[model samples]
Target chain A: MSIILNHVNYIYGEDGPLAVKALDDVCLQIPDGQFVGIIGHTGSGKSTLVQHMNGLLRAASGHIYFNGEDIYDKDFQMKKLRSKVGLVFQYPEHQLFEIDVFSDVCFGPKNLGLDRREAELRAFDALRKVGMPAELYYQSPFELSGGQKRRAAIAGVLAMSPEVLILDEPTAGLDPKGRDEILRQIKELQVRTNMTILLVSHSMEDVAEYVDRIIVMNKGKVMYDDVPREVFSHYKELEKIGLAAPQVTYILHALKDRGFDVDVNATTTGEAVETVLGALGRKGTYI
Target chain B: MLRDITLGQYYQTESVIHRLDPRVKLGGTLLYIISLFLFRNFLGYGAAAVFLAAVIGLSHVPFKFIVKGMKAIVFLLLITVVFNLFLTPGTELVSVWKLTITVEGLRTAVTMAVRLTMLIIGSSLMTLTTTPNNLTDGMERMMRPLKVFKVPVHEVAMIMSIALRFIPILLEETDKIMKAQIARGADFETGNIVKRAKALVPLLVPLFISAFRRANDLAMAMEARCYRGGEGRTKMKPLVYEKRDRLGYLCIFVYLAVGITVGRLRF
Candidate 1:
């Protein structure tokens, strides 16, 4: 019911002098039906690690098992595995090529070996799930606005009905409203399907707000893997490692430093506000 | 995956070659190429070879890279060698299948092959030493006089500069599209001719679309930046034809003159 990695290591240009060990001794298991957020600085190997989950990249040394089966086994059907573990890359919309939005979404389902009618139906269902319009099905995807194009790209993958969805920087390069809309859709998709979701982002606030667990990486190794609040609680440690805590965590830390006895372990804005308000009242009754 | 592509791609080093007035380097490369073509005998080739070795040493780029660039024209060099070795007629060294190998012909073949190799290595030096942006800057400055001919020299240079800038961008786009197709089970490597041709559709479709989008965006960006085609414009770093450049040009002229003299004397 989960994807597990045992001693994963990814090397690029292996034999050449330009070879780089992008990931070193990374080991983790993403449980089924859990929302996991991967946060890392640039060159921290977050992107490389996720690419290995599917067969897009093979590990130099490690094993990735899906539901207790090795994905890279000799008898493994990589094509089917790819369909099951759909990856929507950064700026996934840039991968769109079909003349119409409908065909673009249908591309993945068709590749999954669905017949034309079945594929089209799945495409329509996925578009509806992403809240794309029915009338816009025949319109050119290139003519769509940035946010719609982004949604269409997600629908392109969703049409395959992936059991485990992994998105890399899905909300990158969007207006705040567009980012919220996309994250909302992803949340709804996870809820409706009970799928395991791994979201990779550099934005700590985004990860804190959405994901159930945080896996922070530093220089190709896992620095911390815990709940959002627990991870962000180590504000000084994270800052020293070229990372920032969520804004609420930052405010809470400053409040704790300046004689306010508040809980720094709370990451959510609501929880943070309650902690501060409760502290003020208790202190009011004291000397 | 596209990021792993290693094309030597102008590693940013603050060496003398990087600082040389692009015009000097550009003009120097042209003169060196002309001398390479003009060289007739072993002596002229020897002189040019020494000059090239000196420049390579000064540039501080690993000499191994020039060897890598030579791979592209290996076939052409082989063809030239074979044509001169077996096909040309003179003092017979041997005979093969209605073709004779002569002493002079062997000499011509070797010289021709060496000349071609040197030219490629020399030309690649500019690209290896100079980034595309600097190359275009040099080209525009060198062709500034073409304004009298009503040539779109500046525009052409700008286009060349942008084209170079986007080479990596387009390559990255191509790589992305290829991966996307591969994810869809588009087998590009092992397939029959028809199957391979059909497989290319998935990759090519996305590439062409992205290319067009990039072109459209570039046009808008250019217009927004107040880019007007070839009118009055000023250079931030005005190119001055320098002392070393003049000396370099003089050396090339002497080499070419000596090469022509060697041919005339038949020695």
Candidate 2:
């Protein structure tokens, strides 16, 4: 199953004097099991685009199709769509209100009409998948540290067992170690489940290292939609629109400019390191 | 969806009315509302209408924008008009199906409708023209005498401005929390009132928590900056009456005098 967008458009406050064209005519497709990262500056329509995938927002024009079914059709059930396409909003921890972490995780499955036993089972499985410790299951979500609360929040959505999981800035406001841990868990989850993942993020480095494909948004339009290497190759154009290629991309480019035989399109640190080592005639050699 | 609220919103513009002291605007709005109640005859209403039109024109805010606020009060307007139309005792003008339409009822209905509409528009004009900070500053200055009774005038104004500032922030927070819960397949729509209220638990808990966190953060930040509750504090942009404010006051008093005189005079 896949999601398809056909020339979607949205305008905020359409009739008011302060109307803003938040999303321009946009078309894209996401085949199942592909990890896609959406990156953009604030107000660049990244969040708006993701909200459209799950039917959280209605497009002012055009159509969205989920698994070949028109989501905007009169008989389409939005609630089912929401269950199938789990969206973990920015700061998802703030949505936790249950007395304990386990109950908070169970909220999603329970909302899907699962029996209590089944919901609890799914919640346990999801919590384990997110690596939430057993001791914290009965503890209040509010009492947990920031990273633990974020993990529990993610598990809440995971308990629904969505076919497509979209996270908007999940690592925001997290310390460096916390950000890496969350991203690693998300990467592991995608690998194990092979579910379609669309991560909306501002960090080019995180997107470059993890996502199979990158979609860059600018001023409500899709500026680039390709593999990370190919998208980061247009670093100059990206910079003009208030975004940049990953730090590794710039480093590799600077080395190439200084007459070093480096792959300037390398978007991640590992890839750039390998390229630099090979250029220095130290391929597969130990220090 | 909460964005529909237009109350307490200031319209940005550069115009004569917008430049006037907020105190003058506040006092003017009060006198204008009182004048709406004082007037009884067409002549008085006509003068008030002309004055309102002049102010609206001078303010440079579009007529449609001001009228948009009236939509919220349509139900109240309808109720008042209906009550005055059917319940007032007077000489009968016409009868239909045992329900008499009295001349006095018609007069009362018309005047009441006009009065209510004008009252809302006039009051909204003040808010639309003045920034919340300036309005509260003007209010604090005007109510300085109330400090004699230990009313904590400055603190009250400070609290009010902070509340005003948080309204938009809280609305945005609520919107985010609502969307997050909805994404979890929690249904907010298509439920009975009790079920709907229950659904709101997920949204409200986080909202309250975040609000408290924000309040704590603000309090700490204020204390860090040596904030001690408005005692011996100096204003950044102090309220002062200008030439135009004097003129604005003059126009308001003249309008009030005309409205009262025309209303009391025999036709």
Candidate 3:
């Protein structure tokens, strides 16, 4: 039930003068129900790696196994696999074309050959899960606010009932409130469905707050793959690649550098708050 | 998958042809195409071919690259060849079952093929050597006389240039929309004509909407930047007829004169 990539490599504009090695010898595994965050600067192979997951892209070398089966095998049904593993590209709102919001969401399930009634039911359920109001169901998606359009787009992917949901920068180009709302809903979806989620994002803070595991990429190679705390511990290395740990991690690190007895690996604001409080408690200033 | 298109594509090279005034290249191409039609015999065709070969060699454009454009017009060339080979009346070269391959038909087919090829290569050479912006600039300059007739020549050239620039952008956008629709389980393949056209509804609706959005954004951006329609606009790289451009014009004139003379001479 897990997806495994073995020594995958991909090149763009292959064999031409402008050829680029977009991905190089990358290997990783996403066990079912695991929340994985992939972070990298632009052109660092983050999107290239995610595209390999659902067979949208083929590897130049190596193999991808979905639940212990080779996806590229002669008999493998790619369309079926795509349904089981849904991909929501960045700016997902741009893909909405159906006249109404509900129909747009139903497009995915209907494509899966679900009955009309069943597809509508799934679309309604998905829309509710994304917190879209029932009144907006018949409205044109184009007329919705930016946040509403993004929610409806995610609902479109959710209607497919995919076991694995991979989104590339789901909250990109959103206001702070919109960003937090979308991330919170995604977290709730993962918790409720136990679906394997792979979120590709550059914002270290967003990744730190929700994902159980963080994989950092740099120049077509994996630089670090570990738990959030362990990955954020190497803030110096991450900064070299134009990445950073969550801002709280840096604040803790700054306090530690100034001779405060605090754990510098605290990634989220809550963890940093606790760590600083504990340090102050040890000094008998609080409590 | 739409990225394979190389239309309106410019090949970069440090050569005299690439540096020549785009006006010279445009005028040279028009004159060359006219001369191609003027060729009535082997001598004229030979002169034109040699001139084309010399210009191509001087241009430093790969021979294979220029020849690649010929693949697109292959069907048209084949039809022309077939019509000429079967229909032109002359002394019979070969008589078969209800079909006569006349000597004139054979000659007409060969000359037609040669003419069509030279025409494509001649125009492609101009585009290959000149960038789209420069081509637009040159065209605006050339069409300046039409301004006296209230033709809005500069605006027309500006629109053409903008359209040329948006081709690649729109193509990339199309690819993205296609992928997104595919991810949503909209099958673009394995459908009958009606089904396929219906499927295009999903792709086209989004594409048209995005295109309109892009157009609106571009209009707003132009307004913000004070891009009024082609008035008081000066070129950053003004077109100038250099010594080499004059030489290019001279070469084109000589080639046309030679081709016409060889065409008329009884050899």
Candidate 4:
């Protein structure tokens, strides 16, 4: 309903010896309000594919439709399209250079030709949305921890008021607490802003916990596309592609194979335990 | 776009030259350069040729790689050859298009071109065989006497090493920025010259910003790791000039005499 990539193929180093086909004829439709997670191994063209969403990567030969219009059309307003479909890069914190947090987040809105007042207002609003305090606005992002830098960078994109937000490996290399905080913030932002999210991640656990639908990529091709539950249900397929479902789901499958009636839909540990107790009561296997 | 840069250009090998003390290799290179230009007789040139050939053979670096390095300066090489041939007027041989080629001019052009080509190839061969760190270390060791003149020998070597280290990183960052701009419909190619130049601002601004950021981060990281300037800094592997180095210098000395003779030869 919103973005459509029809027959998109991506090639790196087109004229050089290092030429690689990062994506081949990738067709994906990201409708409005779909929280889609893209999972792929390293070098699986995840970055290249998401880059095409906002016209960051022009398909060597294919169509990228945004809001029912081809984004790459000769007459398309790409500047506006990019604002609508914002991409938060991997290690985006590395892009931070402005002296203070406020100026850094305000960068995108100002670049879009907003007046100082309006840009500052948007920056403050975005920072609040990302849970940064007004006091920290004057502090340098370099002084912030890894997670803060990441959130500040995200706020920079959010200041542009993009309807569709894409994050590439948003929680990579972060400690467990930082990872959890970022994931929680992402979920909160998605609901609070009613924004469509396209999260590209290598961690299957993150995909299972958050995304409504999952897309599996393996070596320049889409291996599977379905709801997270349906996609991860194919456990063998996931393992074959160097991925695994959520630990809880995997354990459920393991228990079922070992002569136990573990309800596989219990994707979380608590859900699995509760489901097991309820099943025992129904099956009269417990006193 | 910056990824196209072939940095370091070291030819990977397990040869004795690659394993030799960089200081010795550096000194050998200087002697070799001096020898290449010193020949004044046929016998001297012949001996130099033999000496250079032996070193090249011993280094075991491919000649094709040295030739490839010469390609970057094909225009400069041509300019030197043309300048010597056409500008240096002498006993006339053939005249065409308001330019006269003489027998002497041809000989001068050939010799100048060969000398320049040899200088480039031989130097590049050294670069291809030796790593940049080794080159800098060698320079620092050789320039140790310059410390007496307060020439900042250590500083120069340190700067060179750091520059060499960051060259590839900067190039990579530029490439990433270029790719990022291209994604935003910044047409880097297929535009008029003005538009092309204008398009470069987006690329340049981000690149400069990122480079400064990287430098700041690197400096901080260095401080964190307790890196002080050359003060009290000692080498992990101290260089020792062995008997092989003496033999190399001797061979190069004979070659220098030959190169001087070649310079004087009429044929």
Give each candidate's interface RMSD in Å.
3.0, 1.5, 1.9, 5.2
Model 3 residue B62 lDDT? 81
Cα RMSD to native, each candidate?
3.9, 2.0, 2.3, 6.1
Q: TM-scores, in order shown? A: 0.85, 0.95, 0.93, 0.70
Residue range A71-146, candidate 2, lDDT tens digits: 9999998999999999998886558999999999999999999999999999999999999999999999999988
Fnat of each candidate: 0.24, 0.78, 0.51, 0.07
Which DockQ values do the candidates obtain, in the order shown? 0.26, 0.70, 0.55, 0.13
Better of 1 and 4 by TM-score: 1
Cα deviation in Å at residue A261, candidate 2?
1.8
lDDT (10s digit) by residue, model 3, range A1-287: 89999999999866333578999999999999999999999999998898889888889999999989999899998898889888888976558999999999999999999999999999999999999988999999999987888899889988999999989888888898998999999999999989999999998978898999999999999999999999988889889989977889878878998988998888778888899999998988965
The model with the greatest lDDT is 2
Task: Tell me the spans in candidate 1 whose CA falls farther than 4 Å from its real position.
Answer: A1-25, A57-81, A240-242, A254-262, A273-287, B1-8, B75-109, B190-198, B241-247, B250-265
- Candidate 3 error regions (>4 Å): A15-17, B57-70, B89-101
Query: Stretches of candidate 4 above 4 Å error?
Result: A1-27, A52-81, A173-177, A191-194, A219-221, A236-242, A257-259, A268-274, A283-287, B11-122, B133-163, B173-260
TM-score-sorted candidate list, best first: 2, 3, 1, 4
The global Cα lDDT (0 to 1) of model 3 is: 0.89
Question: Between which residue pairs do clashes occur in model 3?
Answer: none
Reference-based lDDT, each prediction: 0.82, 0.90, 0.89, 0.78
Candidate 4, residue A109: Cα displacement in angstroms equals 2.2
User: For this target, which candidate reaches the highest DockQ against the unseen true structure?
Assistant: 2
What's the TM-score, to 2 decimals, of chain B in model 1?
0.88
